[model samples]
Target chain A: MRLLSFILGRAAVALLTILVIVTAAFFLTRLAPGGPFDAEVDLDPLVRANLERTYGLDQPIGIQYRRYLGALAAGDLGPSTTYPDRGVSELIADGLPVSLRIGLAALAIATAAGMAAGIFAARNRNRPVDALVMGVASLGVALPAFVVAPFLTLLFGIYLSWLPVAGWGDGSLRHWVLPVVSLALPQVAAIARLTRGAMLETLSADFVRTARAKGLPERRVISAHVLPAAVLPVVSYLGPAIAGVLTGSVIVEQIFALPGLGRFFVQGAINRDYGLVLGIVILYASALILLNLLVDLAYGWLDPRTRTGR
Target chain B: MLLEVSGLRVAYPARGGEVAVVRGVDLAVAPGECLGIVGESGSGKSQTMLAILGLAGPGARVSGSAIFAGEELVGMPQSRLQGLRGDRIGLVFQDSITGLTPHMRIGDQLAEVLVVHRGASPGAARAEALQMLEVLQIPEPAYRLGQYPHELSGGMRQRVMIAMALLCRPALLIADEPTTALDTTVQAAILRSFAKLKAHAGTALVLISHDLGVVAGLADRVAVMYAGRIVESAPAEQLFATPRHPYTKGLLASMPRLDGPPGGPLPAIEGQPPDPAAVADTGCAFAPRCGIARPACMADLPQPAAVGPAHRVACHAVEPA
Candidate 1:
């Protein structure tokens, strides 16, 4: 029963958050100076006015907001201004799955590699091995995806011909490799540093000392007692970490010429396709809220003190 | 003897040189005996026990020998040391609140010792865990099996920690200030449970604390530590009746007596215990703080002199009486 209420409360908050995001995106996009039809040609002023009227842009801001909310209530994301025949929801449906697949894959690679590096550094702390891990992680963090992406392409795609330089792969493992690596490298570095610090702190906790006192092997003591506490901070960080990965995929998809949400979001904002932009914002906000909720529930499960609110 | 430790020294590397925290201390615990090590904070009492079990933290360098059940433990490989841990040597720590993993359920934590050390099956381990809780006099042992450490009160959590340590029926148990974090009444109750468990299992116990009253109640013999060395040792009653070392005398004198002045201020030992790094190898470390420090005490380190059949004192002013 308590779990039920907790989840219901989170769901309610998630809905409210999505609503606020949608409202803000709607107003901001509309307030931008030029309409989607402006850059196409210097058409007659009367023709442009008629086009505005046809798209409901000539109506009062409040009236347009009400109509948009009504459409949203009926599960309609409305039609795109640039691609007049394509609905906003239709565009999203086409792009979302592809974006999600790549995002999930990158997140998996980041978490696995990051945790391994962190644990290795912590186990061999203050040694040459620890210094080596931190030094590499620092370099990874300093190089942004744009710089790393092209460098990787040049090295593997052009120099050695090891992996494909550009374009998303078609249902093959080789296709996703470069994009995923470029997207995941920075996250992996950040997470590794976070885990290393947390692991060191957890190692010094009294419970860890108690475990060692039991004469348990160092391996068991670290894996069973120390890791659980250390992993908690990483779990909390995963919420924002995941959000960064999703947003980062936009740039990655554009650079690689992929047909994911990243490409659509950029095109929508440039073309001033307000409905499409708002639709993507709503989706991203919802994903963030849900991911954070899941993290909170998992955190409570791992540390019982959080469950009781003590 | 269940355990014998001789010439045990634990040092940690610092900026200039390594400082020995436990300096060549010798101790012995007979089977089924409760030996209490009494000292102020930083006196190296706890480090001595940790070094014996190889639980000292990083940078700690331990030397000399620790013999348990006829096996040398001082330089034993960690793998071999693990085999004796939980199965033959149990340890309970000072703070019950942080002594247990907050994430694990009480039953699983207790059962893990048996499963990991004795290779007991899950079903059998659970049964033994429940039984151990009952032996510790915890109410509703079955219900508690599902609860986490945070769900229990301070005293209950301590009892659970003790139960976890005793699950494999270890031959020797080391409890370091086990009741220090509890209230006076809870401390007494926990001590009572310790006494009962000791009688029931006949486990040799090494109880380390700064509380004279706690040692007087449960220990068969007492070893008084001062600045990384044992200054005096005797049967508990004998040490209290006639303390030889001036430091030991000061310790006993500071304990509030029930039959003494009702409204007077309690006596306190002046000055803090010496830092492990500042202790010199050539002279008595306690001489600067000792009330009866003589010219000889300042120049040379005193060696242990037998005062009675079993009583020993390490002080320049103390002569065999």
Candidate 2:
């Protein structure tokens, strides 16, 4: 019953947070230097006025916000100013699947590879293997996705011609290789460091000593006792790490020319496509809040001490 | 003898060289016997047992012979020792809070021993765990089985730890300062449980504590350790009545007595324990602190010499019998 209430409380806070983000995005985008139609050079003043009136941009800020909120409540994101013919929701439908496929895949790979490396390094601490894993993890963290993307393209695409340089072609596994890897690299590095530090600390914990004294095999001692405690810090880290990956995909999507939400987000922002931009912002904010809630729930499941209301 | 340790030494690597913590020590425990080892902190009483059990930390250099049930344990491979520990031998630590895994339920942790050693089914393990808790006189055994370590009180957790250790019915049980972290009432209760365990199971016990009163209650034989060596060893009654070593006598005098004057400062042993790294190679480590330190006490280390039947002491001032 307590856990249920805790989850409900978090969800309510999440909704409030998303609402604040949406309100901020709505006002901030309007406050930027130019109107969405300002780029339409040579257009007659009367035509521009007609265009603003049609999109409800000519209305006062209060009326426009109320109208947008009404439409948002009804699940209508309005027509995209940049695309003219496409609805913001329609554009999202086209792009969100591609973004989710790459994002989820990258997160999965990062979590698996990073935790494995971290556990290995912690177990073989102060040895050559430990040094080697940490050295590579350092390199992974140092090189950003933008830098690693182009470098990987140069190595695998230009020199060896082993994989496709860009684009989400045929929605196939091969198309996922470059972008997913570039996205996962820094995340893997961050998680590896987090896991390694937590694992090392947990390895020396008194309970771990008790586990060892129980005559448990080294394997059981690590997996059953140490891993559950050690993974806690890493689990807490994942919420922000996921947000970073999702937002940071903007650069990756632009470079690779993928039809993902990140590309739409960037293009929408550049053209001041208010509806499209607002829709994507709200989506990302809501997703992040939900993900953080899930992380908290996972933490409680793993550690009973956190279950009781504090 | 169920277990015999001779010249048991444990040293750790230091800047210049290795520093010995448990200098060459010898002791034994027979079937159904209780051997109490008493000392101040850092006297290496705990390290001696840890080394004997092969639970000493990494970088520790442990040497000498520890034979348990006709098998040598000093250099036994870890895989073999794993089988012996928690099966033929049990161990309990001081801090009940940290000694148990906080996340694990009491039943699962208790059942884990049976699962690991006996290869019993989970159902069977759970049943046995419940029985052990009831045997230990824990209230609401069924309810406790579902509770995590944090939910239990300190004494309850210590009881759980003891239950886990004894689940496999080991021939020997070693409890190191088991009641130091508990209140006096709780401490008495835990001591009573240990006495009960010894009587019922016929398990040889090695109880390590700094409190002489605690050991005096349960130990059949007592060994007083000072500066990593057994300074005195005798039958419990004899050792309490006529503690030969000055250090042992000092330790006895320091204990608070119920019949003493109502409001007075309790007697205490003065001076800090000698640093393991700086201990002199020759001379008794306690010689500098001894009230009767002689020139000869500083010149050479005194070996434990027999004074009475089953009694030995290692102080130059004591005349050998």
Q: What's the residue-level lDDT of B67 in candidate 1?
A: 94
List candidate 1 stretches off by more than 4 Å: A169-171
- Evaluating just chain A, the predictions reach TM-scores of 0.95, 0.97
lDDT by residue (tens digit), candidate 1, B269-316: 788888888899888998888778888988899998899979999988
Instruction: Write model 2 residue lDDT over B1-321, tens digit each, in one string.
Output: 999999999999999889999999999999999999999999999999999889998889999999999999998999999999899999999875778887888899888889999999999999999999999889999999999999989999989989988999999999999999999999999999999989988989999999998999999999999888999999999999999999999999888889878888877777889988888769988988889999999999999999999999999999999
Which digits, one per residue and each the tens of the lDDT, describe model 2 over residues A1-310? Answer: 7778788888888878877998999999999988788785767899999999999999999999999999998989998999999999999999999999999999998999999999999988999999999999999999999999999988988899998999988989878899999999999998998899999999888898888788988888998899999999999989988997896688888878899999999999999999999999988988888888889889989999998743
Taking all chains together, each candidate's TM-score versus the true structure is 0.98, 0.98
Clashes of each: 0, 0
DockQ of 1: 0.73
DockQ, model 2, C-alpha based = 0.79
Candidate 2 runs further than 4 Å off: none
Model 1 sits at an interface RMSD, in angstroms, of: 1.2
